[model samples]
Target: MVSKIIALSQGNREYVTDMRRYFHMHPESSLQEFETCKRIQKELTEMGVPFKVVNDIGVIAEIEGAKPGKTVALRGDIDALEITEKTGVPYASTVPGKMHACGHDAHTAMLLGAAKVLWAMKDEFEGTVRLIFQPAEELIAGAKIMIEAGCLEGVDNIFGIHVASAYKVGQVDCTPGPRMASADMMTITVNGVSGHGARPDQCIDAVVITAAIAMNLQTIVSREYSPLDPTVVTIGQMQAGTRANIIANKGTLELSIRSFSPEIRAGLIESIKRVATGTAQALRGTVEFKLTQGTPPTINHEGPTEIARAAAKEIFGEDCLVEREKQTGSEDFAYYSERIPGAMAFIGSAVPGPYVPHHNELFDIDENALPGGMALYVTYALKALAE
Candidate 1:
């Protein structure tokens, strides 16, 4: 089934290439994907497909087939991160301090490709195919907004895919459950008295207090949270002090916490807030805390996972599909699958080159993974609707 879908989509390479480049040239962020939505609307119009725009910036394109079947939704986030364009490639992001480092460009393009394929196969398949061009996924609230906009009103199943670099090209890694982690954010600020450097003993240094709080926050997780569970507490940002001659009057700490189990995440959060509060008191300072709830663990529904696995086998002949370990990273698509029975997958795009980490200044994906993503999108939807 997947082989047939891939062959069909490959035949429309020119249109697919054009869509990829157009999206690459004009990028958008979060709910600000207005022009991007217009472009997608135009494409859908060209195909004579009907779609609804909502959340002031997303799209739900509906294409009906000749027969009756279950409705399946295929989602692609239409947002860009705040990272700058450092790839130096000719098709690199044109917007300053903003680029598609997280492969949302590929996502949008591939979903459009799948829409093209799905539209052409309307006569062979049954039921409706919902193409979701969502926004604010990187913010982690895009799925919820689209849901509020009734994107999944009548959808029976949903499907999403991300461009994966962990494996070599053409590889696909996804398990039946707990595919991605729960992502929540945290922040802490400490206040202290400032004094001249000549009399350091007279001042309660916020910088010193921040260092202690940071170290203890880690202990709160390692000693408090279950060792058997995967919990990550990373302080990605810290700020304190003004000059070397003056004792710091204030300090701030920002972090991202992740886990597969909600129980573990809750426990970690409680311990973190407690430690930050106590640490500040012990250092004769006051503290403030803020934590933002993020996506739940992305679990693949049993029904959809089987369809995806089978489709993958048909496309890559079984050897390319691997049951890999669960990832602590979180994806907003989890928000979508959480509401509807669906599967979120990863397609390998790694190539033989300098491996720059995600969000790094030089990260790049192999263009080869483009077709695989598009193929899987169409194959999974067709297989599920047929069932």
Candidate 2:
């Protein structure tokens, strides 16, 4: 079965790679994937696959087997980062200030490849294979919308993949356990009395209080949490005074916190709030800390992990399987896994030269890994449906 799936996936290499390049050239950012959806729907239509559009941007297609069996879902995110393309590839992003730096273009193409393969061989199997092409993954927002619209109603098992530059092309990482961290966005606002900058004693300085809050927040990880545990609190955005001469009355800080353990996540968030509030109060100021846009960790179940690992080994050989440590990065795919059994496999697509990481301006992947990812998805579907 794996051999047959491999042959089918390989035979469709041109189609898959072409789809990827097309998406890369015309990248779309979060929830605004109109053209992207049209392209996917067109290809699915050409293949005679059944599908429907959800929430304007999401696409859910299905290929049913000759007989009824459990349902399995394959998901791919369809969004690009807010970056300018510098790879200079022939298919580099044509859109300004947007690029598929995270390889979501490859992900969508690979799943489309798998969808075509399964549609062609639908009569050979005995269950359903759901091809979910989701949008706004970069914003971490689409999965919940997909779920709320009944995307996972009858799904028994689910699987997804991400492209990794840290490993060689063709390597696969599908370990069971906490695979990715939870991500929570926090906003901290510090309020102080407005006064002239020259009058140091007349009013409280928000800049100084903001600095104190930022520095104190780091202790949530360094001083509070265990050193062995993985956690990150980064204040990515900070805004204060408009001009240099006058003291700003208010300041805002946007931060992101990531952790794997629930207990640790709770502790980190509480500590952040405590530190921010205390620092503000001590400095004769006040603070407003709000936590939102949060998603839980991506926990891969043992059963689905075994299936993914077995299929990957059978398709790519033993050396292709690489055990990796849990990543501090968070995935909205966790929303799906939180309700059902799901696993996310990392497909390596590294290329030579200065290693460009995801979300960077020059990030790119080896096209060779495209077909391998397609093959992995197809093989897993075959294995999962086999009785």
lDDT of each: 0.83, 0.90
Error of 1 at 346 (Å): 1.0
Where model 2 places Cα greater than 4 Å from the true spot, the runs are 194-208, 237-249
For each candidate, give its TM-score against the true structure: 0.86, 0.91
For residues 277-370, write the lDDT of model 2, one tens digit per residue: 9999999999997889578999998888899999999888988889888988889999999999999999889987778888998899998898
Candidate achieving the largest TM-score: 2
CA deviation > 4 Å runs, candidate 1: 1-3, 83-90, 94-97, 190-212, 238-251, 280-287, 360-363
lDDT of 2: 0.90
- What lDDT tens digits, residue by residue, belong to model 1 across residues 1-387? 555688977776667666776776677878799988998889889888889988568999988889877899999988887877787888777888778777777888888888888888888888999999999888888899889888889899898888776667778876787888999888888999999988889999999999999988878667886777778899999999999999998999999998887677788788888898899899898888888889988889899888887777676567888768888878888877878888978888775676766655566678777777788888888888889
lDDT of 2 at 272: 88
